[model samples]
Target: MAMEKTKETHPHTLGECTKSILPVRDALEVLSGKWKLPIIISLMFGNKRFSQIAKEVPGITDKMLSKELRELESNDLVKRTVYDSIPVVVEYSLTEYGHSLEIVIKTLRDWGVAHRKRMMVAE
Candidate 1:
């Protein structure tokens, strides 16, 4: 049909592009924010307590950290573990699903380093 030919010839139309990029959109929906990636990066060192992550991330308020952690947990990117103790201890760590992001994180880090160098050279 003519419509089929048109679709094949113009594969990059808005609708087609949107479908092609839906995975990226979904990833961004989960990972696009000021704190999500940083929080994930912070946990890369190992499991950390709430206070520890806050200190490592720097400038994130308690409220913001709590909210972001909940989001990450809901997305299965982070796991929260609570221990029974006199005072009760809670720690956060990346889940197996979160560990799957290592490649993406490393790629971003490498690109960021190169970008910074490029900017410096431009200056």
Candidate 2:
């Protein structure tokens, strides 16, 4: 004799739902704020100096860019390197851990495109 299998269950309690969403909350905590995502996208292209990142992300101030970059670096999502030269050069790039966000970013980009198209059609 064998035990009969029942259908799987979904979270039915508030605590269960909260527990299920903890990972998403944690990810958002690290990536939150207006500048973090765009900064990350800017860095995905390649290593770039501070000025380059500011230029790439429109409407961002030098101070804000510097602040956001520091936050990203502290979170292990971005790496900053300084080069030895006549003009001291510093560059920013994503870490291997940061590269893990590629798929998430791409998915958000795809959804955004589709959502914009849908909104245009509706309007």
Candidate 3:
């Protein structure tokens, strides 16, 4: 048995290291979860109730949905409103900051669809 070592071909330049790392760090902070994207996509159309959002996004447990929504709300990307009535209604909508993410999300979705199609054809 022989051991093989791989060499690092792409070395990071000072500018490349800074520019490449910052966006990824920021993106991870904002979009770091299984349910984050789905939650954002659900709220894209408009405000939605907790139940409505959960229903619209399939396969998410009630607890997980609640948690992700709270996280987004805390990050200022999502707004939470509660209407005081006989039955309290809590609605979730995107803040201006969240709305700004629409383009990014759409781009990612488009890329994913194209990638999937290419993979299918290759198979």
> Using lDDT as the measure, which candidate wins?
1
- Roughly what TM-score does model 2 have, to 2 decimal places? 0.85
- Candidate 1: segments with Cα more than 4 A from true spot: 1-16
- Pitting candidate 1 against candidate 3, the one with the higher TM-score is 1
Quote the positional error of residue 50 for candidate 1 in Å: 0.2
The pairs that clash in candidate 2 are none
Per-residue lDDT over 1-123 for candidate 1, one digit per residue giving the tens place of the 0 to 100 score = 455544455555647776869999989999998999999999998999999999999799999999999999999999999999979999999999999999999999999999999999998
Model 2 whole-model lDDT (C-alpha atoms): 0.91
Evaluation by lDDT, superior candidate among 1 and 3: 1
- lDDT, candidate 2, residue 109? 92
Where does candidate 3 clash, by residue pair?
none
Model 2 alpha-carbon miss at residue 89, Å: 0.7
Candidate numbers sorted by lDDT from highest down: 1, 2, 3
Error (Å) of candidate 1 at residue 25 is 0.2
Question: What TM-score number comes out for model 1?
Answer: 0.85
Please give, for residues 1-123, the per-residue lDDT of candidate 3 as tens digits. Answer: 566565434565446667888998899888987899999999998899999998999899999998998899899999999999869989899999999989999999999999999999999
